[model samples]
Target: MAYRDQWKMLHLLNTSMRGALKETELIEMGIDCYPDTIQYLKDDGIVEMDGTGVYSLNPMVRRMLNKFMIAMGAGDMKEIYVDVPSCFIVMPFSEEWSDTVFYDFIQPAVIKSKMECVRGDMIPRVGKLSENIVKQIQRTGLVIADISVPNANVFYELGIADAIGRDVFLLYEKNIEQNLPADIQGAHYYAYDRNNIPESVERFAESLIQWKELYRVDVTLKYCRK
Candidate 1:
């Protein structure tokens, strides 16, 4: 794999909207110690690198590594799904039609790490996305949405996610304060002002992780015993 994709994979594993470590960050983190970490992992037959930095993860192998990381004090499972106004850009364009800059940065890591991650962007219509949100909530760990605008898309998805009793996360530009409703104010929200995109995103992701675990435990107990 090329340095760029290898770097992307590492970021996906290590980053959350809580923080992003750029290329320079990795170099400082010891990209020099193993200028060929990807090759080493590959040659050792641990990582499978493909064309132009693209790589396929062997899940069974990854689980073994994850086990080690857990024992060594690696943290909780990290995941974030980007739900949006349009599925216009979900990647693998020819097949899944779900490609976007956001996906580009995040998807590879999620798939490779065997992390629980997903996104909702395909429904171009508000009503459709709303219904789909409920369906997804059934299996999702949490929901993150951007309603920076009084968009029909974000509003309805938020509604459905709440209605289904799934934990809901919200992000909106500081400017949207006037447009959002009183009820929504009670839902967890983070406002990114003037393009401070990464900060708000990270907060929502981390909070969702905590919220999701509680939901999971409570719901599991409710259903399992009944």
Candidate 2:
């Protein structure tokens, strides 16, 4: 109805997304968003409503689209610009304690270092082979994954990420049988002991910091002949 009300609606939608709010789950903060509005936005190509009730961001060439939106004074300036470097995180069981620490503690540490971290639960889709997982893997420039457990999907996705030339930071639980396929043993990796997750995480991060690039340029240069 009113411009202020429309802005409020955008705020609610943005909050739902940014806070990882689900469609059916209402926030205690009181948002009165209706399904129809969400659908309308999707129809307008402003958002993408996929299988299930989850809503996904409708990305645009903001550098170009925003120029038009701004020249016409059509949208909020704040909404036009936000930096969240896409990060793909693959793991085995999501509820594992180490997973939670990565979600709660280690991920924030990575994000604080300036990156947008997305987890399994926060993913818009479910099941092992959903488009959400696939798209995230393709879009992400960085991947921090664990292949300690016997997960076919993890191994499959790891190989795919490698094929796409992603900068993957591999991790596995120490003393545990690596679920990775022997064929892909050439993939780079490191192990961690959950007994000292913090220290192990610190070690992982330190190794990452000391590296010259996300992907090994030197190794690639040397292996070009072979």
Candidate 3:
């Protein structure tokens, strides 16, 4: 497949349920040349096309397409090349605690680990907000979620992160009554306060490094066995 055609085909498949698509749907989506693109992708072994013009990505290729979408959408292609881990910080976006959490804890911890940090606020507001958030989370190597204030948005993003099996680090402020939801109560978290920003940063950095190491090992072993 030509490069652009290949990308278009993959994009349509990734966004579709079960990565399945029909020829009519493709034409309606403005992909006038989708027939040739589907053939190209089929020839390249990236997609399977049936006699009825139904196209689907197998499990493996679907995952790769998802990663490609995230990289393209979030503009984090550098992370793929340099092997620098990226983190997504999920927290309340309001002015009250955003600055303190970002500057005092999240930024320092991420930088100390030589990782790139992305926040919801950093994403351009040009697209669907929830889709943008999901893409950012998909591109990240880690997620640091602050659930101190019981914000619904924070929890929603946290659910997405956890659902995707990303390494998640939970944080909450000290002295707050943390009635963690029942589902996540068993998860370990870091409790911090303004007075201990330095300590919190240090511990967070260490934990991130350790989690990265473990994740690397786990991935390596899985692929090796396969």
Q: Each candidate: RMSD to true structure?
A: 17.4, 18.1, 13.0
Against the reference, the lDDT scores of all candidates come to: 0.42, 0.50, 0.66
lDDT-best of 1 and 2: 2
Alpha carbon deviation, residue 60, candidate 3 (Å): 7.3
Runs of candidate 1 with Cα error greater than 4 angstroms are 1-115, 123-131, 212-226
The residue-by-residue lDDT of candidate 3 on 1-226, one tens digit each, is 2554465456456555444777766555434575567667777788887788788876788776445434333443211111126778888879597799889888999888777788767887766677677766755666788888888898888877665445577888887745766678435588878777999899888887776564342232111111
Instruction: Give the Cα error of residue 82 in candidate 3, in Å.
Output: 14
Error of 3 at 72 (Å): 16
Stretches off by above 4 angstroms in model 2 are 1-85, 126-129, 177-180, 211-226
Q: Distance (Å) between predicted and true CA of 198, model 1? A: 3.7
Better of 2 and 3 by lDDT: 3
**Residues forming the 10-long window of minimal summed lDDT in candidate 2:** 217-226
lDDT of 2 at 194: 68
lDDT of 2 by residue, 121-160 (tens): 4676543444455546654546777777767677667766
- Give the candidate order by descending lDDT: 3, 2, 1
The alpha-carbon lDDT assigned to residue 160 of candidate 1 equals 56
Best by lDDT: 3
lDDT value, residue 181 of candidate 1: 69
